[model samples]
Target: MVANNTGPKIQQEKATVSVMIYLYCHQNHHTPRNQLCNECHDLLNYAMARLTMCRFGEHKTTCERCPKHCYRKDYKQKIKQVMRYAGPRMIIHHPIMAFRHIYKNLLSK
Candidate 1:
């Protein structure tokens, strides 16, 4: 039998179960709320951690300056677009129509 070693990122993802637990206990229970809560919480935590760890420069991007947290070389075009627009747009804005953008993106792909 082989043991599968999880990376730090995977551990962080597992840590995000807290958010799912939180949202679940909120009492607005929906059928898919479990998945939503886990994924949403994980993303919130990941995004927050990414922001907190950034070494952002005036000229350089969070992705460029802190590639570990922000860069996705495999999704080059998507990362570039997100870095250029979504990165800055998300700073002051709450997640209002962000769901629409995400739906369009994921549904299309």
Candidate 2:
């Protein structure tokens, strides 16, 4: 699916899963897919599910390991800091609360 150019430059899309898949395929090509154990499959599947991106065509998402900015439909918790940020971000959307949090955490004695 061609992505509708939403801004000045045709937004570049990338997927983390695609990268993982690429490596997975590369590695698997050497060591047949059938030989891959359940652990490997599960780990790869979960990683792919998060990093795969379809923001352009097919709307699939890619992995975050890639050096691109695509909406990752995968779990944010895959990274520790992302998980931590999401919680506080939701809990304190109010400007006043945000200010309080900043002062409390950063500037207080």
Candidate 3:
């Protein structure tokens, strides 16, 4: 089988989502550090699957900026909540990734 070589942007997107979900789960669900609750785990898996199959592939924009809405309604809402809660905290918890994401957004505009 051939390997699917996703670019750095896709990798970063996965990492960003993972971090966001972890932060949300840790704070709101009281999940253990570096661990995810079942609900969050399921959401993360679903999100990753959606990302992997993204029509834009490596050229994909951030979900917020993307023209397409790939997620199911409930999962989309859950992820939005996670992002809303975790976005600000990202600067404190993971500054490099946070700033990179911000920089990318600026460049994309």
Number of the predicted model whose TM-score against the real structure is largest? 3
Please report how far candidate 1 places residue 98 from its true position, in Å: 9.3
State the TM-score for model 2. Answer: 0.23
Per-residue lDDT tens digits for candidate 1, residues 1-109, read 3223244433332333233233433333353533444443544455445434444322222234334445344444433433455433432452433343344345433
Q: Highest lDDT: which candidate? A: 3
Note the residue pairs that clash in candidate 1.
none
lDDT digits (tens) for residues 10-106 of candidate 3: 8889999999999999999998999999999999999888887777878787888888898999999999999999999999999999999888777
Q: TM-score, each model?
A: 0.27, 0.23, 0.92
Model 2 regions more than 4 Å off: 1-35, 52-109
Residue 71 in model 2: shift from native, Å? 14
Model 2 residue 47 distance off true place after TM-score fit, in angstroms: 1.0
Worst 10 residues of 2 by lDDT: 8-17
Q: Please report, in order, the local distance difference test score of every candidate based on alpha carbons.
A: 0.39, 0.36, 0.89
55 in model 3: Cα distance from truth in Å? 0.8
lDDT of 2 by residue, 28-70 (tens): 4454633544544454565443333224333322222323444
